[model samples]
Target chain A: MKPLTTEEIRAVIAAGKLRDNLFKATGVFCLALALIVIVALVADMVIKGSDRFTLDFFLNFASRRATQAGILSAWVGSLLVMLVTAMAAVPLGVAAGLYLEEYAKRNWLTNLIEINITNLAAVPSIVYGLLALGIFVYQFGLGQSILSAGLTLALLILPIIIVATREAIRAIPAMIREGSMAVGATRWQTCRYHIVPYAMPGILTGVIIGLARAIGETAPIITIGALTFIAFLPPAPLSTLGDGSTAGLFDWVMAPFTVMPIQIFNWTSRPDPAFEVNAAAAGFVLMAMVLSMNAVAIFLRYKMRKNIKW
Target chain B: MQIHDNPTLKAEARNLNFFYGEAKALKNINMPIYDKKVTALIGPSGCGKSTYLRSFNRMHDLYPGNRYEGEIRFFPDNTNLLAAEVDPIEVRMRIGMVFQKPNPFPKSIFENVAYGLRVRGENNKRVLDDKVEHALKGAAIWDEVKDRLADLASNLSGGQQQRLCIARALATDPELLLFDEPTSALDPIATGAIEELIHELKKRVTILIVTHNMQQAARVSDYTAYMFLGEMVEFGKTDEIFIKPKDKRTEDYITGRMG
Candidate 1:
């Protein structure tokens, strides 16, 4: 084989540049297309729903008349469901991730668990709803309550949080672990002092993003039979204390719940065009909440990476 | 100091054999570490000097599937360190290690130095502050880092980080210290500084070091052990090992005739 001449080399370099530029342009174009669609949708929602985007809209309950409908119950329900999901998922997922990464030996059983967890992440969200319906709603006899809905969503996002936690834990270099171990720290102590703190930002980011996804999830909660219409707020944990009600803090967990997405779904399904506007407003609110959560996670990750050096 | 006919042994390895799954990483080995003295293990790469150093504290326990066949006995108690009943964590507390790379935790300098004490549940601020300062001074880094104790350890220079790790290890008041090519990642000046620190540290703690640099082994060690192919070929006074080695392999290695 002969080596390339200067002209041939130049031609090859030019061709490489051309191919690189073509790929870059193609990627940019696809990204721009997606961005355009998202902008168009958000803009349409804003224009259509701007009239209803008011303090009153947030304060009013669902009404028979679309013009008077508000998302007070839906937003509150969304907040409650997310609270349950975060509380249930974060610790459970992190513990499972820690066990898998730090303690579990490389064996058939661990490998099997790892594979199934990854597979579970890809299973459709609605399937989780069915599982929750079967277990929490029927077998456990918890019925279609906030507890059932929260548990179902927790299951839905469990795989995501676990995967993220593992990734975050894995990002820490082995040298840190060795450093801690060399100093005579026990396994649990090393994990608590060195590994977990170093990986906290990553873990929190994962949990927040998981929570964001859970906030927007409608199918699974709907499948678990979350009500689309609930005029009265789910009794707050302390709401009954000073309100002369018989309900206790424990009642809220088993009480019926309605989330924002379900409320949006219900409004959009109505025949009235005004109800469509209401749906758009509610959808905008949900989008804002999810995007803000993701933004906060991104900001935290940036700060953590900036402050921490290996 | 008056010399005794028999030196007090800090730790002793008896016919030690180590295996990494099916492949043997070390053969039968016997060596004694003297109290308050420095022993340097010298050999080329893959000669198992680092492996032998780690065996003393069982650093290899962090990984699975690695096995040890013989005992390394701790003095005073005569505990077989290689035995399953012996806890590696406890062994490590008394025998601290400085790795080839300066791996200070990503934390404040004070926190890094106090980590050992903190692990043992010493939460009193007064105790931690006093001990942390003492350790930093012991490692000869207090003069440089005294004012910046709250700064991130990672912000320090390579030599400073290594010294901070030394301080962290020393804060526990260990009986022995292991240096596995502790200066390999540093510049010549930093290496010289670490060598000086090692020389001073032997006054209070037993020291064992492994180094590929023959000059470094000769310069800093009181006794030298020459290893080749996972076996110790010669062990004697540093002067004798470097100048008058009896074994042909040791002679060849010291003379740069073979690696």
Candidate 2:
């Protein structure tokens, strides 16, 4: 390298330093802008609904009036629907993932199956609703029920669950499996005893993320035509099929029922100005519910992480 | 001449060939792993020693598209180890393997040792505790881990972890044990401890060890097999191979030739 005079050195250093600083400043500005947007959005949501968030907002049921209305039914309905979705989806989705990751051959057939699953994940929520109506409701005579709606949403989110589960399963090293098998454990036993336990945290995180998407979904459940008004607790001793089109006490899972988002949508659509506040309050409820669910998920993840030996 | 004989063979590899796709990693490996002896597969790096050790227990099949051909039998029945109907899982239980690095599961030290037993469906706590103690003692780490059994296995030092792996493998009561560069990831002290343990273990379980450390092979092994580029170069008693190897290549390898 040629030795440079002081001025030449200063000029060269100045050019490189300025270029580096300019890029650094741009990165800082981008980060600041993103933070500002997040804070502003959260501030707005809190300001609008903070006044209405009384204990009753979480405690009581929905009303047609703005001032007196609470989101109890919607909250309860959402819980029932979410629990139903979790009940239906988690095992099936995880099983599909296990099969794809551990058992599925790396042939064109498996590739095609994987491709189709990816496509299914991308399909619009409303399209799932339509499919649910035609196939689950009219075609299969499952009817417009909470169970049917939960199943519909489950199917909609299954692709994501499977993909995430596969990712979790894939994260475990081949060494762990071999180590287990080296001790003479069968393949299924190895997975059940070793791989699944190790992969559980990621699987739970993925399931929670998928469930979050399902919770926020409105179009499909609406398309499944879950009822907007029901003045009773969901069936406690639940049945599996047929309670939507024609009402019967025994038919629990297949019966049509409303969820929080659907109820919120119904309230928000009303011409009455009072229902508007209720909808906003319902938004708060929904957000709080999602936040708590997320908190639980985060807690589990932390525990899983803390508990892992490696 | 029949160089090694056993009342009951711990393992036998007959014309064993291993391929990672088309590249042969081990070729025509005909050897007897005698019962209750430390049989070290020693050679220079990339000399198919580890490959041969892994092939004995079918650890070679873990990766997709990797293939193994020819027969590997286990004693005393000389079971057809290569038969398609033979479950590799069972073979693994009978012929446990330890990797180059100590790999304990992300679990309590007690649980790590108990993993093999758990897979065999042992659920009684007292039995598990007894077996864990037995294994830990067998691997020469019972005093170190007998108290803190609930602690994570990663908390153990390098040599301890390797011993824990041995204990875990031992918990399965394997007929033969394979060590694939077991001390390669360990320090000199840890390596010495492991080498000493391996020497003692030969009284009970047959051991097939792969080692790059020439001194380690010479110190610990009863019989030695030399391999080069996936082919067996020499097979003889440990002293004969190290002190006066018949093949020039084996002598060169023992004396650091083209390796």
lDDT of each: 0.90, 0.83
TM-score winner among the candidates? 1
lDDT of 2 at B256: 79
Q: Chain B vs. true chain B: TM-score for each candidate?
A: 0.97, 0.95
Clashing pairs in 2: A60-A72, A61-A72, A66-A274, A145-A255, A145-A256, A243-A255
The CA-based lDDT of model 2 is what? 0.83
lDDT of 2 at A155: 94
lDDT of 1 by residue, A1-310 (tens): 8999999999999999999999999999999999999999999999999989999899999999988899998998888888888889988999999989999999999999999999998899999989998999999999888888888888888898899889989999998999999888998998899777888888988888788888889998998888888888877665654468666766878878799999999998998899999999999999999998888888888887775788
Question: For all the predictions, what are the DockQ values?
Answer: 0.81, 0.70
lDDT of 2 by residue, B1-259 (tens): 2335444566778888888888988888888777888888887788888877877777766667878888888777879787778877777878888888888888899998999899888999999999999999999999998889999998999899999999999998888889999999999999999999998898788888998888999999989998889998888789889888899999888887667
Whose DockQ is greatest here?
1
> Looking at candidate 2, what is the lDDT of residue B40?
86
Q: Cα deviation of A235 in candidate 1 (Å)?
A: 1.9
